[model samples]
Target: SNSALDEIVHRIITAGLTDAKGETYIPSIVRVGVNAHHSISSVSMDSLVALRVESSDRAKGKRRLEKDRARIAILDESSIVASTLAFSGCSMFSRMTRTFDVVVVDEAAQAVEPSTMVPLCHGCQQLFLVGDPIQLPATVLSDRAKDHGYDHSLFKRFQTAGYPVSVLNVQYRMHPAIRSFPSREFYDEGLEDGPNVVADTERPWHKHACYGPFAWLDVRGKEFTPEGSGSKANRDEAEAALALVKDLMVRFTELREPGLMAVISPYKEQVRLVKSLFRDKLGAEIAQGIDVNTIDGFQGREKLVAIFSGVRADDKKGIGFVRDERRMNVGLTRGRSTMIVLGSARVLRKAGPWRRLVRDAKARRALFPFTRPFDKSIARLTSDTYKVEDEVYSEEGEDEEWEDDEDDEQDVDYGAESEPEGDWIPRAEPGMSDDYSDSGRA
Candidate 1:
């Protein structure tokens, strides 16, 4: 839906609009919304469009909206009016005396009930709430608030209450190999790969077994929490992930573009560590090409390649939020052509879904060990003449095969008490506002 909106906005900005009488003219569009800190008022509108930014100075914005009413009325008649949920309920829009024939909320399941209610307050004959309740819910921090159902989204409430839901079963985002496990494990095998995805989702790297559509690198690394930090990170895992990313970019020139690859972790600290490592090892300009984010931050987004760093390797502490099935689903489904998961099999195998994921990877011949001298292991796989049937080399190019004998061991039932080692915090970089939201959601 966002893609469709982006295309519409691009057309209006570049080629203007054509009316029924073969006349074309530029149209006036206004985007009214603010990000978490009110720093970014316009979400994605072009500079040509008027912006009514919501901020502390509400009267000024209201006056600006009033002056733009004629243009707004023209947009209402010929095009769509776009506004954030919070801004839609602001007094500026209420004073416009405009109602819509239809209203559609994208990613509605990520918004709390009250937030979803904002845009609906405006009169609309038809309403569409587009979201998946099975993914991450609203990010409510207070346990007391959650107990009172503050985190439950209106979309989830409706789905749980047996309201009619239209399932968009056809997914065009992931390669079939990458989509198989999640579809069977989470969606009851109801999800189908689009024809286009099946034909076009294969990448040049897929020729190597290690870089196929789906794979899991067993990183038996130790996880540690930094002093005064409320999250966990695994240096070994971060290095291994970085190595894989570098190998891919070096071997394939087409994959060296920004936003083509992403690194996702369940822990904020892991994300921070990976980003720091990327900048230090790959340099600032080149590192900027790859996105590093937390699992919840990467929802509703996709890339050509995704590297997942599961920072929990402690058998006693269990897997932390990495055990959340919904979060795992989001991480696994984000890569369009390649999904490589880096984790400790000994730790991940304790959870049900994760154990199945590792087992599935092994069954598909996509499991590999992140041995010492990790760079060489990566190089072996990315070599121009490397063949998939090269006997599966490990450290020093020694022959090795991944074993899963421990998969049958008794499973541990970790309770909710086994929470993460540190409290979750919003990611912040130097010279950036602490409240800056990078989740790419309104």
Candidate 2:
């Protein structure tokens, strides 16, 4: 994931610091001289500012036309610039007789065998291939080829051959409640949440007694509709999800950030429905902060909160795209703290993995009915301008402690909900253990 790099970039831009350690790169000059050119090696704060101004200028593209072709050639030939080369560029470079010190490939599990070889053939002394095979396999069009294991990525092949591999056990992404199911079901309870994620992080969903950071909403009434020639959509689930979005937006105003909350589903048609409903009810400004898309659209991205709209509610026919356990694995792990699932429990219980999740949510007291009482909570937000946490001490009286009324506690009936019995829940294949060892040899 780019999460590690993203955090580093965030720190650099905010602090104008270069080194990841305590050391900082301080330039002697704050502003570039009129005649003197800028350094190309390290990017400074001034370079970022220049880039921003250049990018915003409407005439920036036109200015390229004014420069002479020979002048451009001269500028290009003057410096040896380093840049990120794509897979095509790596193949082209491999044709030449150049040698590299080290080559690092991130997300190597998604790359095909031949594509991974292109970069390895660059005469690099050391190569680092990083990714998890359990997340996604390589795409193979031919069924025969896939049957022979063409779909297995180079990383998976290496792992299967008894090659040394390291597993990152500490996950700083999801909260313990959200991470619990995936960790036990997928990683054998190997994943551990960082201390800060459990302590410092505030989950606004905790205000709801029944629903913690992880919960499921029952939408067994929804019906799937055929979209285009292949996809499907569910109007009932989409509407319920939209209502939950409205409740969260108006009630948790402080937790709202642009793209902080996302609505993800397996079907593209359902994604569109939720997006349209979200835009219609919440308006553009509030809707802009929420992302509505399919499960594949959300990989490699994490948020403070997420809602999964499993639109498949058919009884005769089983869960269509939801049958892919990998998609469910990726979706369950995306939420940093809170995750709400709205789907047909009856329909999902037919599937192996979905049934397991449905059962886990119920056992943890995180299950809620589709038409559960939300009016009382939403009404409180509509009438009160200030949030419960926003209350501060005043000269007239001290700040009152925020407490939930008896009705709010009674809203979620954990014991009343019947468990889906006699349903076969599939056991996920155990992945590599959390215990990691360094080979010191690549």
Candidate 3:
């Protein structure tokens, strides 16, 4: 997960920073984000984890490390080069008076007030801090830190200070149906679909029309706790989500583009379980293409379909992390066309935000009760491909098998892809095209 951000910086530097001749044009680009590792063994370009430029010799080679440090110190305003570094990376050169034309902070809401101000102190003419305050906030764990206002981000503070702010109204991701609720609830009905986008109400992709755009499969009675993870895993929910994936694949078999989908959970353990289920039921190719991650993972990204698995079912525990409204906003707004949510409605209704969402869903008839078990016939095509396991939990030692080596960290970068704007989204660096738009991080 930590390497996810690193991987994005790598891609942006490698793929996005090219000139008209299709060559690396930037005189220099530096990445200062702090992540656990530089490279990921089984990294996906769509991963939610973050990447950082390591300056420590123990982390990277001496030659490369020195090069990175030098990139931050370079203050050539005349040269058409870009430097990417973390706030701390800039702090390393505090003794030297360095300045630039502009400084763009990608996830401004995730940066605390002080750190965000460091880059602004440089004599920059224009400042662009892009982030959605309604989504995830800066990760502040300690109570002492909260008391000191470490949880308050500079973006939110700036917005509250009556700074000139522009909200992007048109979103290119989720189907209008799925986007409607979050747009109404969080954005004051500011989000709209792109002009070229046509969201079908009925099943244009399926021969037999089915309920669309939004679907809720209630798995109230079918969740259980796994042995060692100390987290709940719902076999019924997992099976149902996989079955939905199968149905989508078969229904949209003729589509030109790959069926983009995601299975999102609020917990890493549930993420692992869903990923395992996807692989075991579907296969490797399908699993790789479909992102399985936490709500934070889908931040700043959108997909054609999003299947949310609310893993917590215990009435007493009160739905755990899903109770947070900000997280719900991120989870609900990730899909561009369809959002199929699997959870215990009875349990979710206990939370105020989810209750309002459930109420809205019921009023719209987007809610579908999980009265019957998963339809085996719905997956007849995939039945021959792989056998569905009856057991919920993975075997001993198998749980650890799927665990990645992202290291234990609370906050990691989850970079989202910007839709190709006839070519590429403009970078924050100088000497680049000034045209750019909000990519809708939430």
Which one wins on TM-score? 1
TM-score of each: 0.75, 0.67, 0.66
Query: What is every candidate's alpha-carbon RMSD to the true fold?
Result: 9.9, 15.2, 11.1
Score each candidate by Cα lDDT: 0.69, 0.56, 0.58
lDDT of 2 by residue, 270-366 (tens): 7767777777878767775676756654555566678888777766665655766777887787677678887877667666667678677766756
Lowest-sum lDDT 10-residue window in model 2: 416-425
Candidate 2 global TM-score: 0.67
Off by over 4 Å in 3: 1-99, 118-123, 199-203, 206-211, 225-230, 254-259, 371-373, 377-442
lDDT of 1 by residue, 131-218 (tens): 8888877767667999999989899899889999999999987899999999999999999988798777877788877887998888
The residue-by-residue lDDT of candidate 3 on 317-408, one tens digit each, is 54556667788898887665667788877777666667677677766655555534466534431344533232122123221211122222
Full candidate order by lDDT, most accurate first:
1, 3, 2
Task: Give candidate 1 misplaced runs (Cα > 4 Å).
Answer: 1-31, 34-46, 49-78, 383-442
Clashing pairs in 1: none
